[model samples]
Target: MTLLASLTLASCSTILNNLPGVYSIDIQQGNMIDQSMIDQIRPNMNKRQVLYIMGSPMLTDAFHPNRWDYLYSNQPGGEPRMQKKVSLFFDGDRVIGIQGDFKPSALPVIKESEETTVDLPPRDLEKTMWEKITNLFGIDDIDRSTESDRLTEPGPATSEPTINYPDDSMPR
Candidate 1:
C-alpha cells in the first residue's frame, strides 16, 4: 500500500504534465510598418508616394479618403503582445501630417517618384504614449513634438545592390 501510494503520486504529476491544453493561435491583423518605413514619409508627399513607400494602409474609411491608418498587432504564445498605430493625414493628394509611435528624420525631403529608397540623417528618438502624456503634464524632460523632428529627404543612391551572394550552382 505504501509503494502503491508513492507510485500513484509520481504518475499523477506525469499525467498532468502530459495533458495537452487547447492551444490558442497567435493572431496578427493589419499593416506592419517599421520605423524605417515611417522615416520615408515626408511632407508634401502625395498619397501615391506614401503608398509606394510604406505599402497600402490597413484601414481606409469611406468617409475619409485623406486619412490613412497603419495598424499592427501581434500575439505570441506565452509572450507579451505588441500593437502599433500610425495615422497619416493628407491634404488633397499630398501628405500633411503624421501621428503615432514614430516620427520622421531630419534629412532633406526627396520628391523623386522614380527613386524609392534613400538614406536619411538620424534625428530625435520617438516617445511612447505615456511619455507624451507625461510631457503634457510638464513632468517629463523629453519632448517629441516640434518642427525639427520631421523627416528630410532620401539620401544618395548606392551604386551596388546591398545583397550580392556568391554563385552556388547545384550539382545536376
Candidate 2:
C-alpha cells in the first residue's frame, strides 16, 4: 500500500509543475552582439579594434585558430529561443572576412547620443556613534562647537611617513 501511494504522489509531481499558474524565469547565454557594434566592424581592421567594439567572442575553437565567433541567445520562459551570431575570420592579426546572422551596412553611420553630467554637493555626517546617541537623546555633545567653527577647524592630518619604492622596469 505504501509503494502504491508513493508511486501515485510521484506521478502528480510532473502535473503540478505543468500547471498554468506556475512561473518560469527567462534565460540568456553567451556574448550579446547588437547591430550598432556589428556596424562598427570593418574588413582589414586589427584584432584589438574588434575586441574594443564587440567586447569578446563567445566561442574560440582550437581546431579553427583564426576564427572568432560571437553568439547570443535568449529564451523568455515558455517562449521559443531567439539566437544571434557573428563570425570574423582573421589573417594574421587583422580581420579578413565577416560572416553570420548580421552584416554591416554599405555606409555605416554611428549615431552618438548626448549625455549630461550633474555634480552633487558633498554629504555632511556626524563622525562618531556617541555624537549620534547624544543628538538623538536631545543632549549636547562633548565638543559643543558652532557650524562655522566646525567648518573652519582643520581635518585630521596623517602622520605616517611615506617610503619610495623601486619602479617596475621589467619587460613584457
Candidate 3:
C-alpha cells in the first residue's frame, strides 16, 4: 500500500508541474533597445541626446551616477530567456564611453527603408445625406465636376492603361 501511494504521488507531481495546453505569455522587461537605435549613439553626445536615442535606461545605480545601464530580457512562452545589456559611461553631462552586447561601428549604419512613393489619384468623397437626397430628387442641378475643376499641364504619357471607376451617383 505504501509503494502504491508513493507511485501515485510521484505521477501527480509530474502532471501538476507541466500541464498540457497551459498558455505562458511572452515576458519582456526593461528598455527595448535595438541595433539601429544603439548605432545612433555617439561619443561626446549629452545626456539628453543619449536619452533621445537610447530611451531611458533601466538601471542607474546611485553609487555610479555617471553610468547608465540598459538591460533588456525577453522570454517567449517556455523558451529560454534572452538578455541584452548596454552600459554608457558619462563624464558630467556628455557621454565618454559605451560597452555591452553591441559596440559602435566605425561608420554609423543608416538603414534606408524600402518604401516606394506612389502618386495616387484624388479620392472621391461620399456625398452628404442632404446632397444625396437633393440629387435623388433632381433638386440640385449644380455641376459638381466643373465647380472644383483643376487643370494641370499634361505630363509625359505612360504606356499603362487608365482605369475608369463607375460613377457613385449611378445605380448599379
lDDT of 3 by residue, 1-172 (tens): 9999999999998786578787778999999977888788888999999998888989999999999999999998857899999999999999999899987877966879899999999976788677888988888876566423534545559978876667775546
TM-score of 2: 0.56
Q: Tens digits of per-residue lDDT for model 2 on 1-172?
A: 9999999999899677678988978899988888888888888999999999987888898999899999999988856899998999999999888899988877866678798889999976755777888879888737767799989989757778765657875454
The C-alpha local distance difference test score for the whole of candidate 1 amounts to 0.81
Off by over 4 Å in 2: 1-18, 117-172
TM-score of each predicted structure versus truth: 0.47, 0.56, 0.57
Question: If ranked by TM-score, best first, what sequence of candidates would result?
Answer: 3, 2, 1
lDDT of 1 by residue, 1-172 (tens): 9999999999998776556783557878678778878878889988888998888999898998889999998876434688999999998999999999888887855545775778999975687678878878989666555655544544558876675456875444
True-structure RMSD, every candidate: 30.1, 17.7, 17.7
Q: What residue runs in model 3 are displaced by over 4 Å at the alpha carbon?
A: 1-22, 113-172
Candidate 3: residue pairs that collide? none
**lDDT at residue 3 of model 3 (Cα atoms):** 100
Model 2 gets an lDDT of 0.86
